[model samples]
Target: MIALPPELLPQLGEGLWHLFTVFLRVSAMVSLLPAFGERSIPTRVRFGIAVAFTMIVTPAVPALFAQPNLLAMVRLVLTEVLIGMALGLSLRLFVLALQTTGSIAAQATSLSQILGPAAADPVPAMGHLLTLAGLTVAVLLGLHVRVAQFLIHSYTFFPIGTAPLAQGLSQWGVQQIARSFGLAFALAMPFVIASLIYNLALGVINRAMPQLMVAFVGAPAITFAGLFLLFAGAPLILSVWSDALITFILNPLEPPR
Candidate 1:
């Protein structure tokens, strides 16, 4: 790459700084993402991916960085980063919700002990399955393409250097995040309900036959039932989760007032 003259260095600096903001936002999203953002991936690789994303994104949003003043430029760049992070994280939150369902399922079905790749924080067996399913669906549905489309459309609506977001949008975002918990629970409810009934039956059996090793017998029974339910319900559960993901991605961007 040909180096710019010393006088133009300042302008170059500004552009690169703007790009760094994009990097920050994209990196934050990648950090939280399902497969690409997992802890198992090396930090260097993540940084590289962020740089590549920044390069791809910076050109599309150049109008946002036309301000020549340093402070204004800084503010614009920060805004870009925030917007990118918010967009990326909004998509990521669904994956987190799926993992939440998995965690609940694993605990309920006594399958938490099964070892698996540590996805985020500490992952359980169900967490792995959920993450895998979500990732698969995301990839299959071309989430990357849809996300890019959303980002592009966001510029048409919100534009760069737009005013700060309204309190209502922020509040709405918080509500969306809060709703994910309920969505996750709904996905995991079948397994949870099955486990509850199975455990209740075991308790009744123990009371009715004090001498029997209900605990030992109940273990296999619950495990088998849980596995069977998981196999039966995985398809429908994934469908619901995928629909939720699409709805979220299609929501309009909230421009700052």
Candidate 2:
């Protein structure tokens, strides 16, 4: 092996340092990404994905990753981690939106805690189904490529070496949280309305026939209605969720159009 001149070593180190800095942001994002960041996947796989993504994204923003002193590097790393976590959390919240909707629907339809795996966060079966379906659809829609693009574009909002604006981020956080809950409620609205109607009709029937056991009569009817609604509306529900996630990835700072 031929040894390079001592002077070239500093340039090599600078290049490697730049790459490492980019890797920090990418790895941080991937570690908390939705399906990519799932607990089911191995850490090694996620690391590989982050490295591969860093390689792809570094070229797009070379000027952003300049060499810096130790103090600057520390600040930059911290900034990158925060930015990555923000991006990842944004996407993760999309999944949670579906979970919220499903839980609301299940509870409304009297189907909570039936047939879903108890070991994984104790979600209702309907919640598990919707979450799994949304994740699967996202993967099929080229989520990895979308993630790469998102990271590249994120510099627009959270530029390299610079921390995000705290006041703006705080407002954005509030908006995103409120929006998630609102979307969940919207998705579950049909079931809620159905539940209200079921209870109202049951009340009327029990009032007319005081001897009737309305709770027993209403349970099966509500459950069956919920199952049919799920069967009928799943495609629309998943499509809405997928569009929302993609919208956030493409333009996280903007509100949904």
The number of the candidate with the highest TM-score is 2
Candidate 2, residue 210: lDDT:
97
Q: Model 2, 1-257: lDDT tens per residue?
A: 99999999988887777788778888988888988888888989989888999999987875633577789878888988988887788788887898899899999999996885642656788988899999999999999899989988987767778888999888888878888888899999999999999989999999999999999988889989999999999999999889888887777888643
| TM-scores for all predictions | 0.79, 0.94
**Residue pairs clashing, model 1:** none
Root-mean-square deviation of Cα positions for candidate 2 versus the true structure, in angstroms: 1.7
lDDT per residue for candidate 1 within 128-150, as digits (tens), equals 78778878887799866766566
Clash totals for all models, in order?
0, 0
What CA root-mean-square deviation does each model show from the true structure?
4.3, 1.7
Cand. 2 TM to true fold? 0.94
What do the candidate models score in CA lDDT, each in turn?
Answer: 0.74, 0.86
Stretches off by above 4 angstroms in model 1 are 1-28, 51-65, 116-120, 252-257
